[model samples]
Target chain A: DTAVSQTPKYLVTQMGNDKSIKCEQNLGHDTMYWYKQDSKKFLKIMFSYNNKELIINETVPNRFSPKSPDKAHLNLHINSLELGDSAVYFCAIGWGNTIYFGEGSWLTVV
Target chain B: GESVGLHLPTLSVQEGDNSIINCAYSNSASDYFIWYKQESGKGPQFIIDIRSNMDKRQGQRVTVLLNKTVKHLSLQIAATQPGDSAVYFCAALRAGNNRKLIWGLGTSLAVNP
Candidate 1:
């Protein structure tokens, strides 16, 4: 019974291929976010959705798209993956700025 | 210009010892602070949090101290055990319509038995 869970815990794909990472939260949170952690362990926010509405979209590339079909789910799709896109992606759910994170999905673009 | 950083990259402590990890933030608008523990090959886990109005908050065996004047935040763990070994991160959360959460570089803590 995890509060937050993500699919494709580890994925290896060729460059230019497309892939998606899915996330869901059972904590009844109104806000969900996607954060990318680089090799340096620097966590950068990519997108934030509140009640399935796009709230905060960072300066990420257009190839990276986030979709929230409902408040419980948020999925990220990356097109034309690059070597620089190889990093751990985290899904977080929260309300009022306090967050709970998923186990993380490691994406490796070769 | 907005960033959160840790003072040390790594920290080592013996079992039963107290551990202190420090962080500094440049954004004065941030009104909330949080500490997270990320174990190897796992996502970060929330540890503790404090508000700008409070100077200190404690949870279980962990304590978070916030110094708004100096923009410093510290997490203190009592009776550090090997299980407590992980990378600790401090994040600053700005309150308002624009929700920007700034994360620190993280401090790796190794507790020896």
Candidate 2:
């Protein structure tokens, strides 16, 4: 079974459009994270939730918001997406020292 | 700002040959380090990891070497195969309340037969 899963493997929308990507992990981990991978293949942490509590929030703009209903689920909502919002978003669950990531959701804003 | 960066952006190796990817981190406080491999259309996969206390760690066919003095890390793959072609990234984690990892600009590895 897939330990971590995210919905909408691919998302394509026009500028100014809003969308949400949902993620879930069955690993029963206490901490979950949202990462953005740019075209240069640089992975950057956007947000992290430890047991549904916001722990890490990077310099990301307010247009992007992350919500974790529970420890098992974390979702990202982007408002008024822009061209720079296009990238691959990955959901990950961390326990101890290791982390497991989902397949990733590709977001493209035209 | 502290960040993890790679020395070479890309590396080409022949099948059955050894490959090495290097990374440099600016944060000396980072105690934990990990190497990840990412294939096309997929998330980064954990390859190997090392701590500041250890200088080298070996896995199935991969090895991770850490140099705390210079804050450098390297991942070496033996007998690289075509399936091993992917992007390799090095990440560092400091000992603190923040568990967020600082990632490096990945190095693209191409294994040619």
Candidate 3:
């Protein structure tokens, strides 16, 4: 069973288009996170939800929003996707001191 | 801004040799540290972790060492194989930061046979 999974393994869209990436975790973890990995392989945290409550919100732009319907699912919605938004997005679930990440979703905005 | 960074961007090693990846963090408040391995087209995988209270922790073939005084961390791999070639990242979590992991830019490990 895939502990953490995200839909749309690859996304390619033009600028100004809005798209959403859905994530789900079956690990029954209390905290879920969204991270962006740039071309340089630098991983940066964007948002984190603990039991469906917003906890960590990095300095990401307003156009990028994260919604967690429940502790098992967290989705990212990007509006007016710009060229800078092109990167790999990963969903992760944390328990205690360890975290498990899903196969990332590659997003490219032209 | 406080962040975790790696010293070398890339490292090449022989298949049967040992490998060590080093990382430094500017946040002295961080108490928990972890090392992750990421293969091509995949997410980062947890390898080993260490806390400020302890200097070293060992896994199957991996070891993590933390130096709180210097705010440094290192991951050591034994008998690295071709499958071990991947990008290794070090992350730190502050004491009161709700476990938000501050990540390092990753070191690419190339294991040559």
Candidate 4:
């Protein structure tokens, strides 16, 4: 069983479309995070939730919003997606100083 | 905003040799740091970690060094193998925030056979 899993491993859509990516972790972690890995292999933290409360939010766009139904799941919803949003999105769980990541969801905006 | 960065975008090393990956962090308030390895088409895997109170920690074939003076961190791998080839990243946790980890751009390590 995967400790962390994400839905829609690959997403392809047109610009201005709305899309969502779902993530879940079974590791019983209190903290979950959303990260974006760009074409340059730069991994940036987009948002972080600890116990369903937002703990960290970087300079991300307004079109992107994250929702946490519970401590085990965090979903990201993007509105009016743009070509710049074409990247691999990852879900991660933080336990102490160690963090575990999901397989990642590749999103492409054509 | 403060960030963690690497000295190089890529690293090439021969198999069986030791490998060292370096990182520089701008935030002294960071209390914890980690090293992760990401292969193609996959998410990052945790390698090792160091806390602000410690200078170094080791596990298996990996070792992490933290220098709070220069705000620097380094990962050392023993007897690098071909399977060790991947992008390595350094991330830091804010002093008060345990969930948030500031990530680096990553350094691609190419292990030559």
Candidate 5:
């Protein structure tokens, strides 16, 4: 019973390549979020979806797009990835005042 | 454009000792706060949270203290064990219509045996 899960625990691709990371939550939460943790361990909010509606879109670049097919799933798609995009992408589900995070997807662009 | 940050990036403590991690947030409108623990390869895990009305909240062996006047928050772990060694982050949620949480750069805790 994994509450929140993200696929492709590790992703390695060459520069200029495009990829996607899938996420799902079984917690039946109404809100989902995508966060990026850089090499310096700074966690930044990228996007958030509430009931499949885009709620928050931070200063994320246009290359990063988040799609929510339903209340239980939110996926991140990156176009023309760059070396600076290499970091850990985390998906989370919010429950009232608390948020549960996935294991995280590590993306490395060479 | 408020930022949440930590006083120290890393802290080391011996087993059975109490550990305190400090965080400073610039947003006065933040009404909710949470503490998360992240292990080496895992994402941050929820620990405890506090509301702006309350200055302190406790859960199990963890306690969260909030100082609204100075816009500071601290997470204190009692009798820290090796299992508690992880990176901890403090996040704040704005008070109004939106519920987006602003996260701070984490503090890595190392519990020495």
Candidate 6:
């Protein structure tokens, strides 16, 4: 069974388009995180939700919003995406002082 | 803000040789440290983690050494194989009430056959 999974392994869209990426974790971890990995492989935290409550909101622009319907799901919605937004988005879970990541959603904005 | 960084961006080693990847963290209040391995087109996988109370921890073939005084951490892989080739990252968690884990830039390890 997949512990953490993210949909749309690959996404390509034109500029100004809006899209959403879905994530789910079967580990039953209360805390879920969304991370962005740039082309240079630098990982940055975008948002985090604990028990469907917003906990950490980084300096990410308002164009990106994270919604957690429940403890098992966290989805990322991007509005009016730009070229610079193209990168790998990973959904992770933090539990018991450890963290696990999803396969990653590769987004490319043309 | 606290930051985790690596000494070398890339390291090349031969098969069967032991490999060491070093990381430096700026936060003195960090109480937990973790090492991750990320292969191409995959997410970062947990390898090992060490608490500030302990100096070292070992897994099957991996060992993580943490030096609190120097605020440095290193991961040692024994008899590295081709399958071990991947990017290694180090993350530090602050001691306070927060869930943010500062991650390092990453060190690419290439195991030559």
- What are the chain B TM-scores of all models? 0.95, 0.95, 0.94, 0.95, 0.95, 0.95
- Model 4, position B17, has a per-residue lDDT of 100
Per DockQ, the best of the predicted structures is 2
Q: Model 6: residues >4 Å from true position, as ranges? A: B95-97
Output the lDDT of residue A88, model 2: 98
Tens digit per residue, CA lDDT, model 6, A1-110: 87999999999999999999999999888899999999999999999898999989999999999999899999999999999999999999987777789999999999
> Which residue window of length 10 is worst by lDDT in model 4 chain B?
B93-102
- In model 1 chain A, where is the ten-residue run with the lowest total lDDT? A92-101
Candidate 4: tens digits of C-alpha lDDT, residues B1-113: 88999999999999999999999999888778989999988999988888888999999999999988988989999999999999999998764445677788899999999
Docking class of 3: medium
Q: After the best TM-score superposition of candidate 3, give how far the Cα of residue A62 lies from its true spot, in angstroms.
A: 1.4
Instruction: Please write out the lDDT profile of model 1 over residues B8-99, one tens digit for every residue.
Output: 99999999999999999898877899999999999999888898889999999999999889989899999999999999999988865456
Over all chains combined, what TM-score does candidate 3 have?
Answer: 0.96
Candidate 6 chain B, run of 10 with poorest lDDT: B92-101
Model 1 RMSD, rounded to 1 decimal: 1.2
Residue-level lDDT of model 6, residues B6-109, one tens digit each, is 99999999999999999999988777899999999999998888988899999989999999889889999999999999999999975332477899999999
RMSD of candidates 1 onward, in order: 1.2, 1.1, 1.3, 1.6, 1.4, 1.1
> Per-prediction TM-score, please?
0.96, 0.97, 0.96, 0.93, 0.95, 0.98
Clashing pairs in 6: none
**Which portions of model 2 show Cα errors greater than 4 Å?**
B95-97
Query: Using TM-score as the measure, which candidate wins?
Result: 6
Q: Is the docking of candidate 2 incorrect, acceptable, medium or high quality?
A: medium
Per-chain TM-score (chain B), model 5: 0.95
Question: Per-residue error at A25 for model 2, in Å?
Answer: 0.1
For each candidate, the DockQ is 0.70, 0.72, 0.71, 0.70, 0.68, 0.70
DockQ score, prediction 4:
0.70
